[model samples]
Each structure stands twice: as C-alpha cells, then as structure tokens.
Target: MNDEPKSISIKDIAEALNISIGTVDRALHGRRGVSEKTKTRVLKTAEQMGYKPNLAAQALKLNRRISIGVVLPKHISYFFDPLRAGIRAAAGAAMGSQISLEFHEYPRIGSGDIEALEAAHARKYDGLIFLPGDIQRFSPLIRKISRSGTPMMCVGSDAPDTGRIGSVSAHAYISGSIAAELLAHKLPRKANVAILTGELSTLDHAEKLSGFAATLAIQAPHLTLMPTLEGHEKPKEAYRQALTLMRQKDRPEGLYLSTANSIAVIEALEELGLLGKVQVVATDLFQDLATLIKSNKILATLYQRPFTQGKVAFENLVAYLTRGNLESPVVQLAPHIVLRSNLPLFASRISETDEGEPESDSLE
Candidate 1:
C-alpha cells in the first residue's frame, strides 16, 4: 500500500549511470581529476536520480575542525547584536562542520581594536572576521596577520589596500544618500541639515558623510549643510554634542544620525522638546526605535542588514578556507529604508532591547 521513493546516494547514482564510485564522488564533490564530460554526465545522472549531498558528511571527510576569530566593537549593540546573531545562525546551518567561533569584543572602534587583533592573531585561527576602524592604523597589522597565514574577512566596513580577503557590509554611501534625499523632500524650502556621526577615521562613518554631503550638494543645493558633529559613538559625548547642536542659534531643521548610536541623540532631541518639530533620520532599529517611529518622533531609518552581513561573512570565510574558493568577494547589501507606512514588514527583525548594551560572554 506504501509506494515511497528511497533516498538516493552517490553509489545509486554511480550504479545507475554505470560509472565508477570514485568518479561519481569526485564529480559530485567538485574534486579535480574527473574529466569535464564525465563530470557533466555524473551531475546529470545525480540530478535525475534526485540525489542530495550531505554537507555534514562531506565536511566530516576533511578531518579538521575550523576555528574562526570574530573581532567587533562592544558599543552600539543595537547593530552588533544582530550581526552576531547572523554569524551564529550561519554556524548553526553548517552544523557538524566542527567549526568554533570565538568572539572578541573591544570597548569601541579605534579604542582596543588593535590589541584585540593582536590577541586573536596569537591564537592562529584559520580565519578572522573583523570590523576595521581606521585604515591607516589597521593596515600593517592586518597585513601581518595575513602574511602569517590567517585570512582576514572585513565586515561592517572595509580597509582597502590591505590584506583582507573579502568584505561584507551594507552600502554605507547609499545609506547617506538616502537620508539626504529623504530630508530634501521633507523640507522643500531652504533649510539647514546637520549630520551626527561617529569618528571620521572609521571607513563606514566617513563614507556615509561623504555620500550625504555629495547628494545634498547635487540634489538639494538650497539646503545649507552644517558642520558634522562627531560623537565618536560615545553616548554621553553624543548627547552633549546633540544638545549643543540643537540649542545653537543656527539650529538645523533636519538631523541625520549616520551611526546606530541614535538613542543618545534622540534623548537629547526629546530633552529639548524638538522631537516632532525637527525631522530626524536615524540608523538601524530596535524596540525603542520602533515605538518612536510609530509615534512620529522619528521620520525614517536606514536599516543596515547587519545580520546578513555577518552571515555572509562567516559563510564566505568558511568556503574560502575549506573549499579553496578564494574569490575574494566584496558583498554590499543595500540598506533597507524603514518608514512608518511599511514598518510592520520589518517588525520581526527588530530586537527587544531598550538600550544598546553589548553582551558579556566572549566564547560561544
């Protein structure tokens, strides 16, 4: 009464096609030594037989455990938390790969990043996933680590002309352009707009400022651009700068928080009772940001896909290390613009955190 198809294995595929088991295995696994015509035949036969390769079993054959070092900032947990979540999700997907992820957290970018890099380098991991702060400061160290045989994969931002094998991040320049375009439309009349961001030494923050300034000059020439306020992603510093910027005689009509450290600036805006009066464009999203968005306190946010960036970075690094697939790919995900109208679609991704606090544990 039961007529179900059995699972097809490589042996079944080889037998069905009258080929050697070794040839079938080599072709299926993309191992060299198999002819092109034979590989095509084996692939066709495997597909026709509905064979599925077990990645875990394939990895088990390698007889080695892969270890990865992840170095990221502890500040701005609103973005970094989801980034770690993504890396964990990717590691989970590759279960039985015998992969170990070691997370090393620094206070913030440009602070303890170099020390963390040195510590992780001493361990001699197979690969590293890192967020580069200042290119000039990190170039020599990254090159040293690479020359020592560990591949470095940059995430969140890039350090070019260095030894980084690949990078995965949201398009930072486009995020700024989007913010500028949004504010330009909201304030059709001549108005002043200011950018609140992190240190200019960080590549991502600098790129965002560049994009916003360029777009404002081209599309919204009537809008006056104010001097950038660099809080260096410190909460107290950001709050103080924001408060001063808002209280100035030449107060800006529009504000763009280019970094994920928007809560402090938002609090300052609230303190000055300029919540709804000033059009504010924030970065990333959390529970508090969602509430603010619904209450019209914030206009829009450019959601950088942090989780995807981490997931892709981990997956690509694994592929490069295990399969010798050194494509050195640079993946740039487009920033998701979240408005009040379509906020519900992105509700599932929002983390339930009132404050941006970093996690304590380093090993997982």
Candidate 2:
C-alpha cells in the first residue's frame, strides 16, 4: 500500500546520471577539481531525483572541526554581556556541526587587546570575530592576520583600511545624527550642548561624536558646542567629570552621551539638581535609562541592537568557512529610536539585570 518514493542518496544520484560517485560528491559539496558543465549536470540530476543532504551523515564525514575565536573588551560589561549571550545562543543552535568557539576577554582596548588578538592568530583559528578597539593601533596586527588568509569579521566597530573581510554593527554615525536632531528640537535656540564620549581612539565613539557635531552644525547653528569630555568608559570618572561640568558658571544646557554610561551622567545631574534642567540624549538601552526615559529625566536613546550584531557576526564567519559565501564588507544595521511613547516595547526586550541574557526573539 506504500507508494511514496524512496529517499535519494549520492550513490543513487551518480548511478542515475551515469557518473562516478566521487565526481558527484565533489560537485554536490562544492569541492574543487570539478568542471563547470559536469557540476551543472550533476546538480540538475540531483534536483530531479529529489535528493536531500543528510546533515548527520555529513557531520560524520567531516574529519576536522571548525574553530572560531571571539575577542572583546570586558570593561563594558553592559554591552559585551548581551553580545556573548548572542554568540553562545548561536553556537548552541549549531551544536550539530563540529564548530567550537573560543572566547577571549580583555580588560580594555590597549595592550591586553593586542595580546588576545596575537594569541588567537597563533592558535590558527579558521575564523575570528572581534571588537577592534583602535583601528590605527590594531591595523598592523589585522593586516598581518589578513596576509595569512584567515577570515576576520569586525563586530561592533570597523577597520576598513586594514583589509578586514567584513564588519557587523549598528550605524554609529546615523545614531549620533539622530541624537543631535532630538536635542536640537528639544533645547532652546542658543542652548549650549556638551558631548560625553569614550576614548576617541575607537572608531565607533569617534564616528558618533563626528555625526552628532556635523548634524548640529547644519541643523541648529545657534546651539553652542562645548569641549568634549572623555569618560574613558569609567562610571566613577564620568560621574566626577559630569559633576564638574554641571558646576561651571556657564554649564551646558544639553548633553549628548555617545557611550553607555548614561547612569553615571544622570546620577551626577540628579546630585546637582540639574536632572530636569538639561536635555539628555544617549546611546544604548539599560533598565535605569529606560526608567529615566519614562520619568522625563532622559529624553531618548538609540538602541544599538548588540545581540543581533553578535549573532550575525558569528553566523557570517561560520557561513564563510563552511559554504564559501562571503558577507558584505560592511553590514550596518539601522538604529532604533526609543522614546517614552514606545519605551514599553523596548523595555520588554532589554535585559532586566546587567548580566541577564537578551530575549531570544529577533530584533526589529
């Protein structure tokens, strides 16, 4: 009574097409030494036969396991925690395959980062995903790695001039422009604005500041720009600098936080009783920041979608290694503006705790 056709196999495909099994295998798996005409014929024949690859069997056939390395800074736990979770989730989904991930965390983006990169290079991983701290400082190392023919994907920031294979991140420049637009609309005509950013050595922070400044210059020419304060991504230092800035005779009327230290800045404002006096536009999302947004202490924030960035960075490297499909050199995801009206939607998505994992659902 059973009339369904039997499953197709490589041997079945080869016999049906009057070709050798080895030739069929090479063509199907996209291996070298197979002619174009022969590959076309073999693929067409396999398709006609309703063939499907047995992934378990394919895994067994693979003799070597693919290895990938991820290097990131540990100081910025708020951002890197979700990023690591995303990579882990992706690795779990790919458990069936023989892919292993090695994570390397550094204290900051200087000597420690360089050491991690060198160690990963020495280990000879099939692919690497990293948060490049300073393009100029790391470009030499990156160039050396590229010369060895190992694929590298920059996650968070980019080093275009250094010959990186690709990069996955939110558009930092656009995020800054959005902040500028929001502040320009909220503040007075001649309001003084100051920027608090991480080190300018990093490209992402630099790009964000540049975009914000450029937009303000064009859109709100009357608003005066103040000297930037480098927080160095330290909360205590940021708090101190913010306090000093707020106590000045002609303190800034608007503050643009280009980093993820909004809490420190807000605390300083609250201490100075300037929380409601100054307009604030910040980057990234956190529980406290969301609360402030709801209470009107902070105006809005641009969500960077760090989870998606991490997930895509790992997936792209795996795809390049297994299928020879190279991703675009620069994959920039658009930033989402979260205001009081739509804060609830994003609040549900952001992690409640600092080390908590992000939601499994894909970001919009």
Q: Which structure among the candidates has the greatest lDDT?
A: 1
**For model 1, how does the per-residue alpha-carbon lDDT over 248-355 read when each residue is reduced to its tens digit?**
998999999999998999999999999989999999988899999989889999988788778888998887665433444677778888999989978878883322
Candidate 1 TM-score, C-alpha based: 0.81
- Checking candidate 2 for backbone clashes, the offending pairs are none
lDDT of 2 by residue, 200-303 (tens): 78888899988999999999898888999988877898999999999999899999998875688889999999997799998888877888889998888888
Clashes by residue pair, model 1: none
**Among these predicted structures, which one has the highest TM-score?**
1
lDDT of 1: 0.84
| Model 1 regions lying over 4 Å from their true place | 1-61, 95-97, 326-328, 352-364
Candidates' RMSD to native: 10.8, 9.8
